[model samples]
Target: MLHVTTYYDTLKVTRDAPAIVIQAACRALMQLNHPDNFEGREYEAVKIAEDLREAFDVLIDPNTRAQYDNWLAKQMEQSN
Candidate 1:
């Protein structure tokens, strides 16, 4: 089966990870996926980097994170 990546997975952090940890993870991922760091795959790298940035924005905000957490829980419940 193909594994789906969630925002938490994208950042390499746990769902309950604190904002600081999430920020650090985002930075690390951004650096790794930076377009300039890749050659022929620059476009794909840029897209992944942008996604990391977006995940960071949503997960760093308390209100949005809470909402996202709820949605994630619902998804997991449905999958079971």
Candidate 2:
């Protein structure tokens, strides 16, 4: 299986980071990678922004976030 980092990694936040912090990180990343903010790199920027949005969505949902956390723990345990 391909190893993928957790949503927290995608947002560059700690696993225990609060929702407000995660929201701030998401907003900041979106602004930085917004398609309009890039000139010739609009396509790449848009893709990154989309990924950040997806990560934000998962992390913002309590149930999904908990599930993701559990999965991440298992992955880490297996890796070790």
Candidate 3:
């Protein structure tokens, strides 16, 4: 089976990770993938940064995070 990456994976956090940790991980990853830092690969860096930002937005909100968790749980169960 192919491995799929989720929002938590994007942020490098666990299922129950705290918002602070999520924020920090997103910040750290964004820093590494920042367009200015990648120069010639700015487009690729921006794409990655955008994904990271989307993950951060979803994971940082309690309501959306809860919805996402439910969805993730279902996905895992089905995968097994």
> Which one is best on TM-score?
3
lDDT of 3 at 51: 95
1-80, model 3: which lDDT tens digit per residue? Answer: 65899998888899989999999999999888888898898889989988998999999999999998899889888988
Report every candidate's CA lDDT.
Answer: 0.88, 0.89, 0.91
Clashing residue pairs, backbone N/CA/C < 3 A, model 3: none
User: How high a TM-score does candidate 1 get?
Assistant: 0.89
Can you give the TM-score per candidate against the true fold?
Answer: 0.89, 0.87, 0.91
Kindly report which residue stretches of model 3 are placed more than 4 angstroms away from their true locations once superposed. Answer: none
- 1-80 in candidate 1: lDDT tens per residue? 33678999888899889999998999888888887888899889988988898899999999999999899888888787
Worst 10 residues of 3 by lDDT: 1-10
Best-performing candidate as measured by lDDT = 3
Error of 1 at 39 (Å): 1.0
